[model samples]
Target: MMTSRRDFLASAALLAAGLAVGPPLLAAPPKKYLGVQLYTVREAMEKDPAGTLARLASIGYNAVEGATYTGSQKFYGLTPSEFAALLKQNGLLMPSSHYRLGEEPTNGAPTLGTLLHGWDRAVDDAAAVGAKYMVCAYLAPAERGTLDHYKYVADQLNRAGERCQQAGLQLCYHNHDFEFVPQAGQRPFDLLLATDEKLVQLELDLYWATKAGQDPVALFRQHPGRFPLWHVKDMAKTPERAFTEVGNGVIDFKKIFAQAKQAGLHYFFVEQDTTPGSPFDSLTQSLAYIKKNLV
Candidate 1:
């Protein structure tokens, strides 16, 4: 089976070319899409909800997490139908929304007569907007301050989560630095996670988690697949804890993003609670950087 010189050289050249190009061809990287939390542009949203959404879409945001609906139902304003239409017109998808869990006493609890009247309406509106998640973005004063209080809050979250689940939506809790405070030897954040793995999930705010002196990677390691959403914001190097554009600050997003699979991340929204410049400019820059580097 000895080959001639010409045939042997040709076969060797073909084999070398295939080996050089095969690895890249076989390894197709995953696509990383970007989204925005509307709350980041609260001021602009207040002025014109539709216009603000349009601007966000134009800036390369394909998905949006609603802060409020500013239309007819006044379920913050935009009725589910109207809001859905608005998003459709602008080529955006509404995958999640922030809603205050358990109304304030002044606003009346779910047991109150006025509140009872609209339970179905709330569920209907959420469905209409195509929101898969309804996040409890904050806690009431009575709900915080101690370990016992957080445990109680966690129970309420479980109950609410059951309701959300019935409506084909998942319930999530968004964190701020306060949740990181330790109480009676256990972190409130840990207590919340321990509440009910099935009933409660986390939407980790990377900036706040870092600000609270906790490592985001450690939390991810401690509870794999518990975090479904992430607020990808950067923290300034200053002592005041200022909000900086994504790539301009000290947070290492690339490292955090690498754990997306273990964290069960479904969406990562860019949120700068207070941008050094205009919120729009800040988010635009953040998105550009994420696309260029983190993705």
Candidate 2:
């Protein structure tokens, strides 16, 4: 088909202005979508969600995963659509969110229907913000006490996952080092793994697995495709083993990233829980390292 005069002139203007490369047939540019979990700059997000996202975009991050959504099912106090608009304005997208179940409801524990309804609403809001995954970010200490507890939660997660699937979303659990620790001679993580694989996917936090002395590669080998997301953080050399910016610590990220396909890594996010200086600077350093070595 012949191009119209207006289209041709527009194309010419874009090329002349250096705003676009050329016609799509000549070459198609790759889209770079580097991911960051917003919890890395929790303070900044709390202060100004919009500004923090703008800063992230300036740092070359195009994707974000939220780690905070509590009480009213809002993202940093803004409605889902409001937050989505802010993210769009800053050239960013949120693909995942950490929504907690919250301390297992004290007043005689809400009915299953009530829980699922809440999850449905959460899923709807998350979808409104263009998120694909609604992850159970953390489990409370009081909620987990024995093997039966893990089994029960697994069942709950399966039902929850079914509900999430109904809304065209995936449900997952993010783990910390505590899951590796034995409880009643069986690790809670193991119970989670034993759950219906299709129902409860895992989002592995690399630093915590390493800190707890578990090999991520081996886990991948054991359960391929179970882990689709990763929290890519590094552990410091301190005794407390605090989180540090990637590539400046003891973890072997290059080697781990080499096994990403084997580990079923669909998406990964840079998350440094303890940035000693400016979080933006730390994120920049981490992204630079990832671009040079891991990605």
Which candidate number would show the highest TM-score if scored against the true structure?
2
Per-residue lDDT over 1-295 for candidate 1, one digit per residue giving the tens place of the 0 to 100 score:
0001000000000111223544643434443447787778777876788888899888888887766531233433666787788989998877777665444443343422111234445556777789887676766555487788777778777877777778888878888887888777788888889767677798888888899998888899989989888888888888887888898889998898888778878887887777767888998998888878876
Query: Clashing residue pairs, candidate 1?
Result: 69-77, 69-78, 70-77, 70-78, 71-77, 71-78
Write one digit per residue (lDDT tens) for candidate 2, span 132-203: 877877766665667887788788888888887888888888887778899768788999888777777988
- What is residue 213's positional error in candidate 1, in angstroms? 0.8
| Candidate closest to the true structure, highest lDDT | 2
* Candidate 2 clash pair list: none
TM-scores of all candidate predictions against the true structure: 0.83, 0.85
- Estimate the lDDT of model 2: 0.75
- C-alpha RMSD for every candidate: 14.4, 10.9
- Kindly report which residue stretches of model 2 are placed more than 4 angstroms away from their true locations once superposed: 1-30, 105-117
